[model samples]
Target: MAKNKHSGKIVQNSRLLVGLVLLVLSIPYSAEARQKPNILWINCDDLGKELSSYGNQQVHTPVIDRLAREGQVFTNAYANAPVCSSSRSSQILGLYPTRLPILNHRNMSPVALPDSVPTIMQLFREAGYFCSNGAAGDLAKPGKEDYNFVAEDLFDGTDWRQRQEGQPFFAQVQIHEPHRTFVHDELHPIDPAEISLPALYPDHPLIRADWARYLESVQRADRWVGEILDRLEEDGELESTIVILYGDHGRPHLRDKQWLYEGGLAVPLIIRYPNSLNAGKVDHRLISLVDISASTLGLAGLPIPIDWDGKDIIGGAKNSYIYGFRQRCGDAVDDIRSISDGEYKLIWNRMPEQPYMQLSSYKKLQYPAYTLYRDLDQKGELSAPFSAFMATTKPDYELYHLKVDPYEIENLADNPAYQGELLRLKEQLERQLQAVETYPQEESEALIQQAKSSSRKYYQEAMQRRNLGPDPTDAEILDYWNHELLLNQKPKTKK
Candidate 1:
């Protein structure tokens, strides 16, 4: 009987040991179930909210639409600026476009972000998350290279997929399709007659054909996004990843890109965070692309850097206002500033030297059909279908009631009825500008020096040429100096 009791106790201890083993195993699964999500930011170039999912019945974007269905859709999302570099800089840095001196669209020179300023990558890396970026086109070099993964191929996201095993990762995938220089024959096999022209464009056949080609390019970008999503699924990483798909800026056509109108600034933002987010929720709060940096940091379980000017959007705060500015696109130098509160938009043009409706770019000048629309607009022939996108210079103040006229066709600045609302937006714009404008000129100058120092090796070689260059003619000396400068500078890597 004692021998039988001993065997029974052994069995009981064995059962206890199995339970303990199960509990220990369950800990990791439970931890992993609550683990911080891996972030995948898919930033597309030159896409607007023209998808059927975003209330436009014109374009089809199945992958982006799927993301919207699976997560939250932000209809009132605005880029910090209407151009790629400025808007994208704001997205990663959480600073306004003007805060960076490179906000001037005409100044296309490299503007390296200071190393002292903390980026989302810096914050995530500190928090034990690996960061990788597959930036597209010219978006990968200069100030952005320090934070993003610089690679040869533009279409691949493999670098982002192979991060550390247990640690979370922040991967940014940028697509450069749909920007200008779209091929007509290859991209747009569809008939131009079938294309619906935005009222801002003259009903010219060439204009419609150009617009169709642009649409085709946008469709191609959607296909690339679908491929990325498929890759995530294949890697079994989709469920654990928080995917956000958005546009860097509006298109580079009429009423887009260089303007401060809805077509220029407003973009589609779809967040698919099944791990921590409730799906199918549509958020219409006026959130800027700058908020993207804050939201990214917040979701990564990192504190929003204090120097960041963007607001943390996960707290259900109703963002009432977002600002926008336009300097120079190509060669047009216009100082246009604007602010929007989802319901109303007010614009202030500091340089009232020219008419508000103008195009300074080479292509637009070359295409007489493109100028026809602007000429018609100046004559008030075409309804303000795309007035918000007009680059033409106007008087100091302009106002539009977005609730009544969402297209911003009618300017109410001269009307007495909206004096109160106009004044309110103006004050709010000034207040927000002042709040984030603390980046001192001296600080920026210091940052510029740091940026210059990054290319010191090239500068040293250029100085050698400068010392040897004492040509008889002034132009020859200048040419030699320029050649030296060019030789020393690092070239942008292959796409």
Candidate 2:
């Protein structure tokens, strides 16, 4: 009986030893599972720093304000380009748009990234994470990726939910609000009287109404943000995902969309992570949207490509000044470059002989604000600040002390007192352009002409079908010039 009892005790000890070994083996597996965090990147179109959290009292953005409260808000974040396609192209490829073929907005032939240049999504997919653009319902059309890019193979699907269980994900959700054709929201209407007009714009009823519509669109965008956050919380993935929300560029106002002013280049950026890195803090560091791709790669524990121009803003060295580039926007042709160190801004307009406000059919026909400015200019009722827009010619160089003149009304480039600062910025701009191997605007225009030929044929056909009159005004002449130069065809119809 004694021998039997001793044997039973030995058996119990062996079972306990086996259980202990299994637990030790599972520890590494569990740690590995938790190492890879999900990434959620959200981007909005034509949105500037209009959020209430950014001190815009006219617009109510509760959802975004809540995000700022929970995440890190960047005060001086800027887009590399003021327009959409170019800015977004620079963002995804981690390189300046000037370095790529798609340096302008709405290129007739979309430029594809070289195979050697891997996107952040591609990097994440190779690292064993499921990647997607957004939910399947978010697709605007069947089999059409919303943004520019011919590389559709990078994303696994439209929805991250389709990913395998226990798999991490990298998803981009693009919200198309506050762009053009501002739709009024009855539920959350904005009061035009409350909006503070900028010094550059005349305070007319029409201008006020337009500004109100923009604010309303902002509120509408906020609601969409709330929906996305709610969906994440419901899925129980809020605690495991890192969220980033920002705009593609500045607002769509004149001199704001295609120009290099703060209204055109600056954007709001908010980031949140489960690790709470600088959570609920406002970072005043100068950051560029180009840095987003590399910063994301760093956060995911992946290596950034050496050839990429972007740097990790969160973990890497901060930039002294952010740079901006402007090429052709729609029918307008321009070559403007700028650099700002968060206090002073320097702009170099290569074509100073050209007018600041070019003839753009899209801008003229679509926006009532443009018509109002034209009428006011003709009547000679526009104030000095407002009259600058209608100037016949622009200065070759413009320098503004942004600290004192936030609206950029004064040009201090000619002032002898600012000569030292101007020289410093000019040298920096030259170095940056050389480093990126940026081509002259003429080279870009030549490529644009080649692509515009096809589009010109289509537009000419449409004009003939509509029985439109001859090109008389500057706007019409410019459009016709673009068409004629590309297609080498005269108009069949007459006035």
Candidate 3:
């Protein structure tokens, strides 16, 4: 009887041991089951809310429109900066460009992101998500992430398919479209006559033609979107992946690409997830691109860093205003800061003595409409709205009631009726500047000198490459500058 009891005890001990082994074996699978969803971020360059979904009849973006129909569309999404480098820097680092050394677009000497500020991808990587930055073509060139401190460390590769099985991923795919030098597509030709001119733009044949070309580029961008979606579906990751589609900044036009106006600051933001949270909804809350970093980390179930300047837009409190910063862009050196509360927009031109239209070689070469407008202004043929771009010097402060003046035509800074609103916004701007730790605008004489030196060097290099003589005529120099600008297809180059 004692032997039988001992055997029974041994059998019970063996059963317990087996149960413990089974639990240990199932641990990894359980963790995998609780893993965060994959993220697919698609960023387009030089695009705004020109989609049919945005109530614009001019451009047909069927793929993006369908995404909007099945996703959440942000009606008031603004880029932190008007141009690419500054905006991209802010988006990646979750900090304002003004606070970083990359305050200007295409900074001559690219500023590295501080070691303390980890990129969104880096956060994902630390959270066990495989991160990849497959942004190529004009969008992933050298200067694109030159402002990023350790850009290479942020991503594993340009592709994420090679990631470990059952592992989540964070992928960024950047597309270049609707930018200048619009590629003419015969199959998707837009009618110049049908193109509607904005109030600020002249209704000329050349301007219409340019608009039509831009529409065609938008169509091309739509096709690229379809291709990316198809790839995601092919991988069987479409439903489970959190997809985000947005533009880096507004359209690439005069007073649009580098200016602080709506044409430059406003962008389209659409997000889709399988959980159906706010799906097919339109969020009118003011959102800045900088908010994306924290929001993305929140989506991945990761802890947002305390030093980030942006709030988690997905779950955090709503923002009352979105801010914009503009410093030196290409060869132009200026200081402009703006704040918008979705209804009113105020611009503080720190360098009020500087002309609104600074002589930027890149702008002069790329925008033919700029040349046309300048010629028209010279001839005294420009009207009120069109003539605004030709102002010798901008006002110290400019205020616009977006509801009444959607195009931001009239400035109400000095008006007695709007003084209260202006002062309120001004105070808000001050508070924002302080919160972001932005310093007062300093003179950029050094930056201007650097830009001129770089421009001369680039010209000389191009001429030498072409085997042209060293002595170039005045006309020849101008032609060379234009040609060099065209050859450098990337928007906002850091020379």
Candidate 4:
């Protein structure tokens, strides 16, 4: 009779233990849910540091400004490349562009990112979050229509409104505004005269008109962002969701997009995490867009994949260096490369003997600034700002001490006084590039050969063109300058 009583007691204890396990499982979150944070990545095309919150008082971006009020703003953020394809690819693969074999701009062939490479969407999906994407431009994968979701409007609030009730999600929204080919008539009410032009652009009527249009696009993007934020608040998911708003690359112009200069690669990065981050915080550390991948994974409590070249920047401090490269043959130039360490920037040219053109720069051609530079150069009324766009017949290397000259108006590469700093930076760049495994085996040979051939061809053609002399009214020289600068060899040997 005592043995039977003991057996009944053991059975009752087992039932109690089972009941406790079920209760814990039924809880909304028991340390497991925190590990699966919903992620939202918002990207803008050809957008740079033009937001009022980032200290650009000219451009109005209230929604992004509000996001800054709620979270951290990284002032020194940079893109892997100045172009759309390579920059987007780096973020998607979580690796640097130099590591990729075919991340060149305008290369119609799809540089297939391997399925093994875990994207931010894929990472969250594996960790129990549904991944969805809405793109406004053709910057992402070319033919992959279903890139996880099929939202009709890339910038609209359709997808964000239809997420599953209790499940975690990773949603990416893109805005098509603020891109080039802008409509000039529909600009914001801001007066063109009040705008402070960059040192590289000439003060001409056409340029001012174009700048107005660009600002208008920014306002449109901001309005749409406000709509998205309001919806999030209405759904009661604003606090739990992590919001990331940033640009793919720099502005569209001669010296901006296809070049390795600050105008091209330097981008605005804002992260809004209501539950995790403190408001009005500013991080000045150099962080790359690729680092977003690791940061996202880290926030989700998942380990960063080994193949990624970016570091987790959520702690607000990281590596001091930022690298940028470009590969596009536009107008009159070929390939180029560049790197920056917050204060200094260096550019490597395959073709060094050619005079850098100011009016024909890449970004200028796409916007109204192209006419301004041309008219100014033709009239010989070039100001310090317009002159800044003219690239010198740079030596094999072009270096600038950004702290001393933020506009990059001076070249210090040929100056022997700073040889130590230059050499040290070069060595660091080489080491980091080598550490990335994605660099193609034939990169050196291809770049060296391309550089030599391009130099020879450009030299011969330029001499012929120079002999003809500047036509008193010819706009081609200014046009050529703008074009050549944009084409300037910014090809990144993606290591």
After superposition, the stretches of candidate 2 with alpha carbons farther than 4 Å from their true spots are 1-34, 135-149, 275-277, 438-495
- Candidate 3 at residue 14, lDDT? 26
Cα shift from native, residue 424, model 1 (Å)? 1.1
Worst 10 residues of 1 by lDDT: 1-10
lDDT assessment of candidate 4: 0.64
TM-score on alpha carbons, each prediction: 0.73, 0.83, 0.85, 0.75
Off by over 4 Å in 3: 1-30, 136-151, 275-277, 438-446, 456-495
How well is each residue in 1-495 modelled by candidate 4, as lDDT tens digits? 012221122223323443454356654333565446677888888787889987889887778898998888989988877777678767865777666453455332334444344456555544546666665433242222222111232221226444555766677777766786553334456677788887666666556656766777788878767766776788887888989888888877666776777888888888888675778889888998889888877776665665467788994438778887665432334456677888888787756655556223233334435455556666778776456554466466778898878767677887999787788778877776666534442234455456445544544454345442322123544444333333323322212
lDDT of 3: 0.75
Total clashing pairs for each candidate: 6, 0, 1, 24
Answer with 1 or 3, whichever has the higher TM-score. Answer: 3
Q: How many backbone clashes does candidate 4 have?
A: 24
Per-residue lDDT of 108-176 in model 3, one digit per residue for the tens?
554444444557776666555777766444323321343523344667766668677777888888777
Candidate 4 wrong stretches, greater than 4 Å: 1-35, 135-158, 183-188, 329-333, 353-365, 371-394, 441-495
What is the TM-score ranking, best to worst? 3, 2, 4, 1
C-alpha lDDT of all candidate models, in order: 0.64, 0.75, 0.75, 0.64
TM-score of 1: 0.73
